[model samples]
Target: MNRLRAVVTEIEGEQNLHIITFDCAGSSLKMMGLDLPKGLHLNSHVILGIKPSHVAIAKHLSGELSYSNQLQATIASIENGKLLSNILLHVKESDVQSFITLSSSKRMNLQVGEQVTLLIKASELFVLEVLDA
Candidate 1:
């Protein structure tokens, strides 16, 4: 899992559903969920988690997208296997890992130091832990 330290900036929802926003190294990220743990409130410090396989990479992306989290990052390193590829990305001050198919990696022609956009769905992000206030 890729973990990022963030602070809760906003929370909006009704009933059990919620849309939580966070400030991660100056980048805004969002998480959607139905259940929130105790102590998760505005200005709360948190550690966000997401699986590497869930991260999507976009190169020269244009037009609009529905994904709530789109982080601009630079490719730090890439390790390709026969079937899968592990890509390390530098986003702001954080480093995020992305797992994609070898075919996709080649098709995108991703290289070290290249610029790419990381796409993450809101529902895929979760509060891995709530930091002490």
Candidate 2:
């Protein structure tokens, strides 16, 4: 799992379900679920969690996307395996890791220091741990 420290910006909804928005690496991100931990409030610091497989990569991307979280990142390192490739990206203040297919890696021609976009759906992201202000 990949973890990022984020600060809660807004929270809305009922007791059972809530739509929570947060700031992660200067980008707005949201999470919607009933299983969110307790004691979260505005400006609360939280750890955002997502799996590497859930992350998608785009090269030279343009136009709007359905994904709620889109972050601009630079390739830091890449390890191509037999069937999969592990990609390390440097975001504003965090290192985001992604697991993609080797074929896709080759097709995109991703290299170290290359600029790429990281796309992640809101539903795929969750709050791992909540901290006090």
Candidate 3:
């Protein structure tokens, strides 16, 4: 399957990295990276300009991530609205999914336009959230 590449367009800071917006060839998704240390402002950082990074792939997206450890994505597509579509995910070939588990229905409910996190080792990405919107 062909892959999508997006540029980091915006970043917001809170106690942790609040949100990241990307220009996915005009298609975009918001990704949550890390938690704020102790006393960090949400606007302390600015969206940075850098070459596109494989930051995330949308799979089982719900709404905005709520759990400090969980994220959600909204399902939207070019042709039709994918309501409760089973989320499909793609990642670096070397990344492992053994540790990630989902219920049978969850695995089945995932559909096109759904969202799933890029879940990876922090070392894999040179993260930045400053400048650019």
* Candidate with maximal TM-score: 1
1-133 in candidate 2: lDDT tens per residue?
A: 8999999998888978888899987789888888557778889999989899999999999998888889999999999999999999999999999999999999999999999999988888898888783
Q: What is the lDDT, from 0 to 100, of the residue 115 in candidate 2? A: 97
Cα lDDT, all candidates = 0.96, 0.91, 0.37
Instruction: Write down the worst ten-residue block by lDDT for model 1.
Output: 35-44
Score residue 119 of candidate 1 by CA lDDT.
100
> On lDDT, who's better, 1 or 2?
1
Rank by TM-score, highest first: 1, 2, 3
- Per-residue CA lDDT of model 3 for 18-89, tens digit only, reads 565555434344556575323224333333222223233335456764323222333332221233222233
TM agreement with the true structure for every prediction: 0.98, 0.93, 0.29
Model 2 misplaced regions, further than 4 Å: none
Error of 1 at 52 (Å): 0.2
RMSD of 1: 0.8
Residue 89 accuracy (lDDT) in model 3: 37
Considering lDDT, where higher is better, how would the candidates rank from best to worst?
A: 1, 2, 3
Model 1 alpha-carbon drift over 4 Å, by segment: none
